[model samples]
Target: MRCDNGPELISAALGEWCEVQVIVLHWIQLGKPTQNAYVERFNGSFRRKVLNAYLFATLRQVRHLLTE
Candidate 1:
């Protein structure tokens, strides 16, 4: 998996899990968003379309909206 140096992705648990799963993680250079352009674009779209469009009262509501 290719990822950035975000704190969540840099956690020991995630690293151990990836190692056990035999998945190699490639970290892009810091401040280089172009390396992960597709995912970045998707994240921006998702934030705008779903996240910013609604206020959820519960997790189930979010899941339901996603399922639709």
Candidate 2:
């Protein structure tokens, strides 16, 4: 249940059911948005491109996809 200021990733029901701790990363304190540029790019790429394009049927598949 971790996100980067996105409501879509803030799934309360899923978090509660899985008992996961949510963590968010912000770049303001880093002086500039580019300070955490890699994470910023990863978030958009993961959310928009990869996540939308992939559909996993099981937790093992999901885990394998992520781990690899």
Per-residue alpha-carbon lDDT of model 1 for 1-68, expressed as tens digits? 99989887899998999999999999999999899999889989999999999999999999999999
Q: How accurate is candidate 2 locally (lDDT)?
A: 0.60
Name the weakest run of 10 consecutive residues (lDDT summed) in model 1: 3-12
Identify the runs in model 2 with alpha carbons over 4 angstroms from their true place: 1-32
Best by lDDT: 1
Worst ten in a row by lDDT for model 2: 22-31
lDDT of 1: 0.94
lDDT of 2 at 65: 83
| Reference-based lDDT, each prediction | 0.94, 0.60
For model 2, residues 1-68, the per-residue Cα lDDT tens digits are 22343455456675565555453333244335465567778877898876788887888887798888
Model 2 per-residue lDDT at 1: 23
Record all residue pairs in model 2 with backbone atoms less than 3 Å apart, i.e. clashing. Answer: none
